[model samples]
Target: MASITGSSISSSFKLNQALNRVCCLKTPSISFKGISLSSSRLNQATRRLSITCAAKPETVNKVCDIVKKQLALSADTAVCGESKFAALGADSLDTVEIVMGLEEEFGISVEEDSAQNIATVQDAADLIEDLISKNA
Candidate 1:
């Protein structure tokens, strides 16, 4: 679990950035908590829920940065732990490239099954940490 404190502003900013990435994909709508949210409504929801991160913030940050770079996202585009690769416009080939970048950056080799399961930035970060500890 991640803590919510004085960094709420930063957290919210990252969340909004991530949400914006998804919105740019032109999704018609998404349902969460039994509520169907249009693009505009999802933006509102993002502002309300940006106080937590499930993994180490540093690891998450690195993953987010790598993803953004791999996808050629603009500087203003924010990538957060919850940001999914598919939502960021990464296809199968792009995903493979992202995994390669991560392997080089983290000095860890992700097994085929593990790589297949990394659908989100958080997923990649979590796997990196797990591999790091196991190797150490």
Candidate 2:
């Protein structure tokens, strides 16, 4: 299977890095895998931080980083569960914004209802990757 990998970094750091990677450039769907973070290194990362994504591990980490930065939350505040948005601390507006950002980043349209249905980062990533494959 195809996968993309990267080193683990702070959530904000990952966001800046991903945004920079796609700065002002139209691109295809990004296929990346999980980011490896040593437990020790994650300790160095912001506290209560949670990273999750529907894409590969690397993409998941990137998404987690961005979300962490936007929400000013720690990793503990984030998760990759299959529940509801309210259960995940995402208001309707936050969900919409996140959906829009993910669409731009991965080139997919996440239906509002669909966005509401996504409770975990992995769910979101899987949806994005599925859309990418369909577009491809």
- Point to the candidate with the largest lDDT: 1
User: Whole-model Cα lDDT per candidate?
Assistant: 0.74, 0.54
TM-score of each: 0.64, 0.49
Please give the lDDT score at residue 45 for candidate 2.
Answer: 35
Tens-digit lDDT track of model 1 for 1-136: 1222236576565544445456434343544334455766665555444444345779988988999889998897757767788767899999999999999999999898999999988789889988998899
The TM-score of candidate 1 is 0.64
What lDDT would candidate 1 get against the real structure?
0.74
Residue-wise lDDT of candidate 2 within 5-86, one digit each (tens)?
4564554544444433332233323334454434344333322232332356666655665555555666555333222344
